[model samples]
Target: MGGTNCPTCGTQLMDGGKIAGRRDPGAQDVSICRGCAEILVLTRSAQGLTLRPTSATEYLELPEDAQSLLRVAHLLVRRQQRLVRAPRQLH
Candidate 1:
């Protein structure tokens, strides 16, 4: 509902409806129209939600919700890495 056109295909998405999926924890899930299903990852960064295609050179900008999800994923990944590196303590 943020952008007027679909980020992947530039098609006009419906004004009001459930436009994306939320079940996936790290990734921002979007329902693409019949044509633009090639995109795979929608990541939210400091800049914004960046829609990246698995095989393409270009990226599509995402809305706020997607952006937030990407930030969460980024934080989670960092936390996991920190835990992995931290020295374990035994008593």
Candidate 2:
């Protein structure tokens, strides 16, 4: 999956607009682009998943596919967090 070039730096992105070597399978926070170093944060809850920039001051945007991936990743992290916070039964 190829990605579009960054508008600011014109860096070509690969794999759904994700930078190489910056992907994290177990990442619960934002992922930064290797070219422009833009932070991509995904948030999820019972409602659904949402992709957005981490900081308001910074104006960075990720491709649509990357945003979708972030949403899924965020959901996974939320699920894991719920499991971790669940109460254990004492036998």
Candidate 3:
């Protein structure tokens, strides 16, 4: 399940990546890598779900519907603006 790579550190995600804690599970959907703290968005297709890197600029580029979701997410939880350093792999 951990096949996706972190855009920031290139660390492979585990368990299809960890869910970014959200108050509104319906609107606030996000995935993150524990190794690099990189945020991502899942794009679903006929094949399956694919995770894409998410940045502040990218968020602005999102469609209005997506923007609305983010807005709702903001009211629910204050997202971290700073980059979280990648933790060392135990291996």
Model 1 scores worst on lDDT over the 10 consecutive residues at 82-91
RMSD of each: 14.8, 15.4, 9.1
Residues 1-91 of candidate 1: C-alpha lDDT, one tens digit per residue: 3442456556544335423332332445433322333333545556544443333222225655744554455355445545344321111
TM-score of each predicted structure versus truth: 0.32, 0.31, 0.40
Query: What lDDT tens digits, residue by residue, belong to model 2 across residues 1-91?
Result: 1223333334454355333334432333455434444344434445433334355332225456865664555455445545444322211
Model 2 accuracy (lDDT, Cα): 0.42
Q: After superposing candidate 1, which stretches have Cα over 4 Å from the reference? A: 1-8, 12-19, 23-34, 56-91
True lDDT of residue 68, candidate 2: 64
Model 3 TM-score, 2 decimals: 0.40
Best-fitting candidate, measured by lDDT? Answer: 3
Q: Which 10 consecutive residues of model 3 have the lowest summed lDDT?
A: 19-28
Selected candidate, larger lDDT, 1 vs 3: 3
| Per-residue lDDT of candidate 3, residues 1-91 (tens digit) | 4425555566655443443432223333465544445456655555544566676776667677866665654433323534444432311
Q: Please, what is the whole-model Cα lDDT of each candidate in the order they appear? A: 0.41, 0.42, 0.50
Steric clashes per prediction: 0, 0, 0
